[model samples]
Target chain A: MNVIVCVKQIPDPALPGALDGATNTLKRDGKLILDDSDAYGVEMALQLVDAAGGGEVSIISMAPNGETAGMRTALAMGAAKGILVSDPALQGSDALTTAKVLAAAAQRLGGADLIIAATESSDGYTGTVPEQMAEVLGLPSVTFAKKVKIDGGVLKADRQTEEGYDEVECALPALISVTAGVVEPRYPSFKGIMAAKSKPVEEVTASDLGVTPAGWAGAGQKVMLVAQAEARQAGEIVEDDGESFGKIVAFLENLKVI
Target chain B: MAINSVWVFAQVTNGAATTGTLELLTKARSLSPNVTAVLGGDASGVAAQLGEFGATKVYATGDLAGKLPGVAVAGAMKAIIDGGDKPDLILFPQNYEGRDVLARLSVKLNKSVLTNSIDVAVDGDSVNATTPIFGGNTLVTTTFTGEGPYLVAFRPKSFAAEASGGAPAAIAAASVPDLGATGGAKVTAVHVEESTGPKLDEANIVVSGGRGLGEADKYAMIEELAKLLKGAPGASRAIVDAGWVPYSYQVGQTGKVVKPSVYIAAGISGATQHMVGMKGAKNIIAINKDKEAPIFGIADLGIVGDVHKVLPKLIEALKGR
Candidate 1:
């Protein structure tokens, strides 16, 4: 079955992430890499398409600056092509607008039998985009999938929950948001990296997709204010005085947790 | 800000409202007097208790027994809103089921969802939510720019839950829509992982282990201590990835967000990824050999000792006590 995976380019989370003070948005002017979370989707999509025998995996991403660096990494992992929606108007777009644009890009790619995405972006963590995309595309969504399988064109998964897991079944052309470590992501090989350069990445804009980036369509959630979250003050730090064992029990009892 | 009505998605489990639902209902009381609870399944058993938390009315949908909540409950709520029974503000608990319903409703109604809200305020005709972003580095107050029936999901323990000593609320039934393809995502089977003691999320005191534990065998100590305290056991991504524990026991950014009364970390160096999930706990105790470990930076009690040596003595002492 053909697949379209939505990946994101997020600032390297290992270092630091800053918000544009003037715009109240995540600063996107630095180096970016494929969000580690999305790697599972990209990998899962490639494996599914390969298991399906000869179907292709395409990618759709919405980022400013035509961020092809992250897209190329996915292509190296075996996605056939990519559609990057990069426009100044699309900047600061909330999860809804991002989903709309990606939905449009899915149509531009002639749609797909399966659409995969990480449960949420590491940067935003809204956990709403993939479901919104499924709604916009009018397809069923099975999110937080821990294990996925295909049988007779049916997309089945073991969806994760608070207590346990639910084995869910849906049709093709459905959307599935996978949790991390669903499968061990494979790194791009030397040959795959070289071929990724020639792999085409078509760029598009909101207007081209027949969607406007103004008023409600631009950003439905307006940022009223952005400030540093009050840092959690470190509590009493006592060196383990052999008496520490007794101290811990008293702490739990004092809190009435024991 | 005289609000017309406020609604809360009161999640019901085992014929009763979840604690998180009660918390949302309690907070909704401060927002408006006309607090309605939108529940799934038979809320008749707990409708009276909902009133104690300030719900004036309960709208429980029918026949969602075996269907996925996202498809059944969300479809029902969409129908209710479309019928012009919309409220000014809708509160959702930031959780698996809550996220599913909120996202589906957001798309169905063409509205925006403000997530991970720590606090919510109403002004004139708008509702604003303060959410911490960038992994708790900063806070951003967000408000919807579009039409009403605004959606906001509160993080766990974001608000206090208390009874207002009110009478039982009236119960009404909502017709569950014929969830055709929407309910196509049917759960075929449920596999409950073998776990001991209380659930990590529901536990009042949580004890978590990290990579500092040399191997998987040492995790027994973490569980032992948790069992002693009548708490729950949790693990960081390092051990979970190393195949020491199941993903359900993992606590971090992508895993469960727990805010137990006290969180104890054994051998964890406190990576930021792990910090974001448990930092909200009321009291944090870190046990690591490294005094400069990042976990100690935010820990309420830092025990600069080896987990191997400290946990044994701690467990032995607790067993005797």
Candidate 2:
């Protein structure tokens, strides 16, 4: 069995002012780490390989050349090999174009028994790429899966639903999008970190996968405008005192709380 | 081209329709007179209700067992695309299932999709959508430049449901294709964690406790207040990390995002991540000892007092009501 996991490098959303002051876009400063949700996908892929007892796991990512750091981190997690589809022209491509590039890479890699990805990227939170990739690759896809298991060459998993959950079973050569609760991603061990340096990482250009700049990125969709984000104003704070407490009661009553 | 028709996916669960489905139909009705509501599952009775929400035609697709909603939605989208009469736009609710289906359908159609849209308007041969970003701290207006159907998923509870007051329309049963992998993955079993508080994501009112509660046991006070108002219980990342509450109850950038009718913060200092989750709430009330707590910045009402004393009083006031 062969498993392929698609990972993305995203900025840490916890930090403040990580936005580019000029473009009002997210600034990819600090360390570019593998998306937290994608880590679970990689972990699930590794688990599947382990369950099969001696299979291969490959990690693929489409990012700028500098994003090799994220691919290295995935390699350190236990993937057999890594592939980076990097080019300077791929910057600012929307989800549709990104899916096209990933689909092309998957085809070039000869496809896999199973493909996994994060439910959504933290930066854009679009949550569209994996499903789009499935569509482009002409494969069935499932999103927000909590647990995945394989049996008799068939893939069975539980995906989180709004009200409850739905059980889905698909044949091999499918795509699955996982969320955080699916599995606790493993931290790279000292041995794994050292071994990652020796692991083979293949670098391929977008053209190598038959992705044309005009069709893939140049014809990409564009957002005509982005409205400015408004800041909320401070509210009136009432001190806790006998008189103020009475006023608070009155306020709640006016708001129909009391 | 003159706008002719619009389609909205009406989500149904346990024989009942969701509010977001009705809201989508209402919005779609504003765009074109030939509005259709597509519903899946054994919930075909919802087709008539779609007419009350201004759907001129209700397309009822019966349930396909073991098929996940993603497959069903994609099939429905294909039906609209191949149904001989094409629609100008397709609308879906921005819930978990809707988001998943729209993402897949957009890819299948090779079209651009706008999720979590707050508003939609039609211009000459184009449509504009508005959505909040950076956790509702900022809003962005975007438009697509393609000629295909523009897919949009609107946020739940964002639009008010309007009455159509018309007779039921003729229901059209759409043939749901047996696209393999409806249930792409099967669940052998399910184990739900025992929980008492309201689900933070689905709650209309939320009362959150923070580290200012001082001790893990003191959370009982916050829970007590939440119960009185029949609201959901939430916590800041600090308290969750400290083991006072489960991570599922945490409200922040890393946690659940809720836009309830009213949000109450008790003893929280209001970190940016925490604020981003609940900032879209209609009304915000904060109770903290420090007057300068950042939670007060976005709060509509603030009380400077010890949570230990304030929470109990608030409960009493709610009980008195």
Candidate 3:
């Protein structure tokens, strides 16, 4: 079975002020890492291919020019090939538009028996794309999956729910979006790192996929990004004395916590 | 042709209706009088309650005794989309089940899915959704420009619960196609964490302990206060990793995101990850030994004192209240 994994290069969320001052957008700085959830998806796909007695695992990503480092990381993790769908036109696209571009690219790749993605993007945190891509490609999508396995041409997965979890089974050529607990993504080794350089990467443009600027723009909703986020003010610290306990009690009482 | 109506996924568990079902119905009622509440379960007499919640029409799919919610929601959404009764907006609660179903339905229907929205207002030919980004530090208002139904998942406990007062409407049982083979793994067993406190996500008041408490045993102070308030116990990532508290109660970037009305952080330094989970809280209180703990910045009330001393006193004050 052939598997495809959709990966994203998000900004290091640990950094302060990771947004660009001029564009009012997230600044890809410090480090461009594979979205943590997508790494799990990639790992799941690799395991599936290996279990199937050697199938191909293709890594797909959409990002700005600086995200090539992330693409290379996926290659080093053991994907047979990489596909990067990047262009200046694809910038500023919201979750919906991003799904459209990805769906179009997946279609151009001649499709696959299985598609995998993280539950949500760390930066966007939308958690909407995998389902959106499945809709666009007319496939069944099972999301928030904690465990997945392929048996007898059927894909079985354990999905997490509030009450607990439910076991489910679906046929091949389906999409699965994994949660964090699914698998621990393996780090690249020296041998894998050396092999990644020779791995062929296919690059595609939005225009080449017939996704025009207007067509690629989001249609459902408009997002009004706030100009600035006001930082919280520094607070006072009372001394660690008997008097401090009274002050703390008084504060909680005033806040109605008492 | 007349616009059909807006659809709200009226989720019911163990025959009890969820709070979000009513909230979404209220929002849908405001958008258009033609609102349908689709309930997927065999719970008796739920249609009458749905009508009280402002549902003009009620569709009960049947009893979902052995069915997965993801399967039920996808089937119901598909039926609504295919019955020549296309909804302009599809609202879901940003809960675990809601997210799963909406994510699949959005893809199946080719609609834009928006999650963690705080507010939704109807605009001409579209809806404007307000969702927080970069945690609750900033709010982004989004509108979709396409022709499909606008899908949104509202954060739980964000909207005020509206009273459902109207008379019952004639119930209709809608037929939904079963998407063969749920496709994926099946659950073998469930291990529920045994605890005796209010659920952290649903609690109105939450008292969270952080690393500043210094040790796992010190959590007793935090628990005492929670008990006094008849609220739930929560913890920061610092405490969870130290095994001071269960991972279920941990609130941070990697744990549950909650929006309780009142949140008290004891000994928490307020890392951004921890802040993102509770920043939507209506009011915040912080108590720490350090004068410059980051949590104090967003806190409406702050007491810079040792939590070991401060929490005991606060618990005493609450006992007196």
Candidate 4:
């Protein structure tokens, strides 16, 4: 019941984000932090492994500058170790390329009953990499899982849909993408943080996994131009004056929604 | 290299073509007269309707038999393409099933994909896609530099779905190929959450609440007001992430993208991500106490007020009417 969770170390999303002028991709050279979205996956994996009673959770991430700060956060939260794939050639890689690298790294780790990831990263938000990784690894994928459970070597997931939810099932050696709020992520304890500083984190390159990254040059897709989106004009602003609700009623009446 | 055929991954719900599928079909027809619909479920029920929307042929897998449609459908399309019946372009909706199929297909074909696009343009032999990034504040134009068939996933409501009044499309049988270990996942059961009123995405009017509502109990005001207006209640990512509501009620970049006739944001100081989902509404009304809230930038009418005071009064006024 060894579980591997895919985590992403991204630039802090609280501040404004900028695109690199040279590569036309989001600038990533800044200090990276753990994407809040991936915390759910790490938490879910930890709980599942704990429930299974005899397994370990490992973190796998691909970030530039050999970033380990984000991975260390997950390690402090109780993951056994981590594998970081960082290489200059990996910059500007598309979603599929990232999927290939991650899938190859998962195979390199080997012997995992399950692999988990966030439905999408907060910064990049491609929302396609997990399923693509499933395709590349030739594994079954159950995405948008709000609830997951293990029963007799089978994985049962409550997959969120537009209407409601579908109970999906698959065997081991599968990938699952979890939605946010699926589980509560625990804060790293002081003892855990001290232990994480000495934990093992293997650093590798894309080539180390036998992956030739289809970077911006080979991805077959290019960002031609980036421009500001059209701005919508501001309308009237009125003080509440204890009667602002009347204006809304009049506005909706004008639109016939009343 | 010449544009000739365009294919759409037509999604069906309740034995009928989805509105998103019809929108893709309409856009595909404009790109090429030879529009084909690739349906994973029983296409017999919606083949004619697909044709009326401009599909000349429907390459359909009769039934998936409970297997995950993404694996089998992607396998079937890969087989069809391997059989040398490839189209120049393919369109899919940026949704669960669509993303699943397109991602699998991209890996199977070793092709690239452009997703979350809001518009597509044709220039000579190339197709360009426009995607809004940074929470719809910035637009990025992208195009494939490799061979066809190019894959692109567009957001729902990106285009208007209009029927061309054409004849029934010819149905072609497409069998799901052997999926190996990837076909292990299956839907065991479905549980539809009990929800009242119109769907958030399809409703003519939408009322959304945010963190300004103070706590979970106050969300009832949003629901009550929405009910009085005969609309759907929505929530910002903040509230949804805080466990105040289900993700289905979320309206944001990572959630549902809704384009309603009138959108009301109460106690919502709009984050750019939240604005991305509801900016397309024909009319936007923002009710927040903070006059400098970013949501007022695009709001059709900005009311400076408190939700606790204003929401109750608004609900009373609407109920009286």
lDDT of each: 0.85, 0.75, 0.74, 0.92
TM-score of chain A of 3: 0.85
Q: What is the lDDT of candidate 4?
A: 0.92
- Candidate 4, which segments miss by more than 4 Å at Cα? none
Q: How do the residues A9-36 of candidate 3 rate in per-residue lDDT, one tens digit apiece? A: 8776566645565554567645677876
Most TM-score-accurate candidate? 4
Interface RMSD (Å) of candidate 2? 4.1
lDDT tens digits, residue span B220-313, model 2: 8878877877788999967775667765687866566788878889999887658867887888889889988888888888888888877776
In the range B1-321, model 3's lDDT, one tens digit per residue, is: 123577788887556677778888777777778888777665356767777877878777786544556656677768867887777777888766677678668657756677878788765555678876665677667766667577788876557668568666457776657556442323345445556767788888898999988878889888888888878899986676455665567786556777887888989988776897888778787887777677878887777777887777767766776
lDDT of 2 by residue, A66-126 (tens): 5778877888999988778887676666677788888887777788999999877777776
Query: Which stretches of candidate 1 lie above 4 Å from their native place?
Result: A214-217, A235-258, B178-180, B192-194, B241-243
Per-residue CA lDDT of candidate 4, range A20-139, in tens?
998889999899999999999999999999999998999899999999999999999999998999999988888989999999889888848999999899888889999999999999
For candidate 4 chain B, the 10 contiguous residues with the lowest summed lDDT are B119-128
Candidate 3 chain B, poorest ten consecutive residues by summed lDDT? B182-191
Q: Model 2 off-target regions past 4 Å? A: A17-26, A29-31, A214-220, A237-254, B178-204, B209-222, B235-259, B266-277, B287-294, B302-321
TM-score of each: 0.93, 0.85, 0.82, 0.98
lDDT by residue for model 1 over B94-156, one digit each (tens)?
Answer: 888888888888888877788878888888766788987766667888876666788888887
Per-residue lDDT value at A31 in model 4: 94
The sequence of per-residue lDDT tens digits that candidate 1 reaches over residues A24-76 is 78888888799988999999999998889978999999888878899999999
The local lDDT score (0 to 100) that residue B118 gets in candidate 1 is: 82
